[model samples]
Target: MKRTLALATIVALSLSLGSCRKKNNEPIAPKPNPEKPAPTPGTNPTPGTNPTPTPTPIPAPPTPVNGDNNNTIKPDESPVNATVSIKLTKGARVTIKSDKPLTITGAKLTETQHTYEVTNESGFGIDGDPETLDLSIAQATEFALDKEMPSLKSLKITTEESLKKLSLQGAKNLEQLDIAGAIADEQTLDLSKHSKLRLLALGNRPDMIGKFTTNLGKEYPSINSSNPSTSTSFKEVSLPTSLEVLFLAKAYCALVGADNLPNLRAAYIYTPKAELLGDLSFAGSTNLDRLMLAYTSGGGALNSLTIKNKPHLRDLFLYQMTIKHTSIDGLPTNTLMYKTTNYHLPSIEVHNTPAVKILSLLQIATNLESADLTNNPDLTEEKLVKIAEKLTAVKGVNLKIEADKATDAVKDAFQKIGWTVNK
Candidate 1:
């Protein structure tokens, strides 16, 4: 019994020791980091959760895709200043918009060649102070001034061909108008309202041989009546009394009588056709200073060139025509004298006047100071001697005769009277 009890005790002790060894081998729970916070539900984690950041986007540049490749700006598209001067070539057009002065000149491809049209599209016209506009074009068939350029003081139109029409209707203050080349046909020009107009120049064209006519309105007078018999009568025609200067070339219309033009200073008429100049009466043009008539051919004997009682008739030039049976009486002694001096007389120039005797013509101009006779094949030495004897009343006279035709006796007769004769 003692040996059995001892063995049981030892078994129990061995089992207890094995249980203690298993309890000591159990694992310990770990502690959390204090530096990091817990993540939210949907958003990303804190910065420490990610290493790299996202980049921002940049925009692209714009492209130029308008107008010509050369990038030249057009004239109309740009702003026009108050005063502008421009020059254009063929096929170019411009619009000048200014309330001030403007001067423009255009040219063609070459100096002699005509090119495409150059136009001005000013709406309000020139409205600047002292308004002045000058336009010179090489060749233009479609050019004009704006209708309401009322303040325009001076206007010059220089072109190869006439504009379709030029109407100075509203240009009241215009003082000078110069048209270089062609003018509009028929009655395209209106000058009745331009009382202040001073200088007017209309150049002649080859095509306008016998087709030109000017109508200065019926308020003044009617030059030509419907009946051909009374066309030369001064009882129907009256002239513009305020007119100062008149010039007509190659125009075949009858002229208004100058008997009423008291202020008339100069008159020039050049007609190539015969019968272009009808009966002319200068009966009362008291202030008349100069008169010139040049004809090509075909006119009846000018029997009505009556320059009676003219006090200021100074210079007279007649070409290619004769004044036969025309009485030029009552020529004033002080006719050609300067306003400050009374010693100087008038100058008479007779060219191609074959039918009219030069000496008989001088009998009317008593105070004649100078005479130029040329191309008179019918002028004989006897007529020249008569002229020399008749001119003896006038002192300090100068005579220029064709040296090839004058005789020594005729030259001596002119030299004996204190006259300077050049043959």
Candidate 2:
């Protein structure tokens, strides 16, 4: 029995030894593949350190004069002045203070996109009597009292809401008036009392424009108010006979039958169009000198810019801006000494003007001593020289010509005009 048991145990021991060797001899399993690569130590990008950074958002726009969006006033806010009293028919940001010679500019009272009912709007209700107190619409519905308006020399009612019956009656000493955008609820405000008025700019006041502008001659002797957009005729807008210098821009006045501005010396007109020939006469002008038309783009041609009447016509400045054009015709050939006057014609400036003619008399520009030709590219050098050659009697003329490339054409013109051409 002992021998059999030893033999079995020996067999069992041999099997166990073989199994242990097999397990020990097996190779270790290869490492499994990772999903994502591991980052290098200390190589991560910070928020602002990235090459492409995110942009910051922009802030909102600020509020206006009478007040702003928030009732709260900020440190960088603009202040209000004392000379100009502000009034509003809406909620806004406003700053109020005292000033001298009350001048209000840079504050634009433009039409807003939202059309809130003015009368029903919280800030739009009409306030107390102007006879008793001047008004201000700075903080919502706050009405300041006890302060009387002092004598004002120049008053500008730029905002429509600020125009009140009380204010106009009070400003007796006002000389230069620019109530351009204002509107009075009452259609008529008797301005016949403003007898001392010299310059008035009430063009955009559509309602009261015709009433006052037409009879300006009777009310304010020497007036400069422009004809409104709504005014159909200038029957009432007669320039005062005593007027010396007249400046009218974008106004619709009849120059056709208009004649004999005898006392006028300098006339400046800028409109869409103008025609001065038939009844256009400026004779008997003792001291007339300059005629300038700026931005006269749309207008009828002056077949007769008759200088026979204006021997004193020294400077002619015409800048064509619109599709229409302007001209100086009927210049007398006997216009001698018109260039040497105290305020003589420095040079005739014509830009974008069409149908230019280098007549025998216009050739007197050779004596111009100094000629300026810019933007009048049509006046070629050859043509200019042809005109300059006529002034052989006058002393050497100083000519100025600007063109692209300073071409041979320009050089040839200078040569013909007896100018030592300078490259």
Candidate 3:
């Protein structure tokens, strides 16, 4: 019995050892209640599981500096809309390319720089009161005037071609115009619309041949017709009725009928061409204050000078004119005889007038204050004495006679009457 029991204990011990070895060789599982989740391969930790960090911002660039060290605002070089006013100096050359309106006031413009050159394709508007305006463009084509310039008073155009492109329909306040070098053919410049225009100067061009027209109702104050090289004759030109001053130098025209110009105050006519100047009668210009006629070397002879009933004619200047005869029939006889404070006495000036017998015309000018008859070889001492005696209203006179014609007896007689005689 004891031997059988000991064998059973040995078998039980062997079985226990084999079971322990098999448990150690098999795989094992992880715990189900873990503290944190597993990490992702290419991502951050879970948002709720970890704290986030702050980010840094980028900086801006600095302002550029100029060489002068001044904070001057430069003009926008691009062809964009202008937001500020443009201020230009005298004789400043600048180009503008804007599609907006511009105002040129007196404070913003200079007299020497009145021209506005627009380069953009769009039309612009002009505001404010500018006294003078000269508009030009790169192309010689007609442009549009968007608005009226009422304060513009004077306008000067460099060429006639430019004048044709401009439309003066809006510039109603223009007064003075200087178109000195306009050379156009067969183009009539009509200024009848300008009612307030006072002065018109058209000189210094030879080939400027075109019909000029003005209003018959609105007479101009002054007209300068002094082109020397003009060969084109005008078809028809109407002179102003209230013309106060007139200048005619080397004008190629027929006899100017001064009978219509009643208010003529002063006139200067000088023709050096060999063309004949027909009878220039001033019968209608009775209130003529001063008259100067220079028909020198190559000019035509004075066919006749009619001073018939001129009562207010004070001064007469005849230079280098050959007067054959005197027409003083209807002149007032001793009309200006009495020296009065109301009226000025008449004065005569004759230089190189050899043919006219000056003594014959002295009877008409009895109240003569002065007489200058120099370089006249046709006058004799006897003729001068007769002229001096006819001046019965004047006790003394300022006389300048020819050197060769003044004799000693003539000098003594003139000196006795307090007359200044230059020999």
Best by lDDT: 1
Can you write out model 2's per-residue Cα lDDT over 1-423, one digit (the tens) per residue? 999999876655434522432332212112222232332232221111212111111111111122222112222222133222233443353332222112232232224421122222223322112211112232332221123343433333333234333235544443334343233333333334444333344322221111111122342322334423211112123333443444444433443213434556555554433442223346555456655443333455443343444544434444342212123333322221212111122334343322133332244232244444445545665665555455454345555556452567656655665554332
Candidate 2 deviates by what RMSD? 32.5
Compared with the true structure, what per-residue lDDT tens digits does model 3 show for residues 321-417? Answer: 5443334433332221111111122455554432233543443344456677776665677766655655454566677876777798677667666
Candidate 1 segments exceeding 4 Å error = 1-100, 103-131, 142-146, 162-164, 204-241, 249-260, 273-277, 282-284, 296-304, 322-327, 334-423
Q: List ranges where model 3 is wrong by over 4 Å.
A: 1-112, 115-236, 254-257, 273-277, 301-303, 322-423
- Model 1 residue 330 lDDT score: 50
TM-score of each: 0.42, 0.32, 0.36
The candidates, ranked best first by TM-score, are: 1, 3, 2
Which has the better TM-score: candidate 1, or candidate 2?
A: 1
Quote the lDDT for 64 in model 3.
Answer: 18
Candidate 1 vs candidate 3: the lDDT winner is 1
Q: Model 2 off-target regions past 4 Å?
A: 1-236, 254-263, 275-279, 282-285, 296-304, 321-423
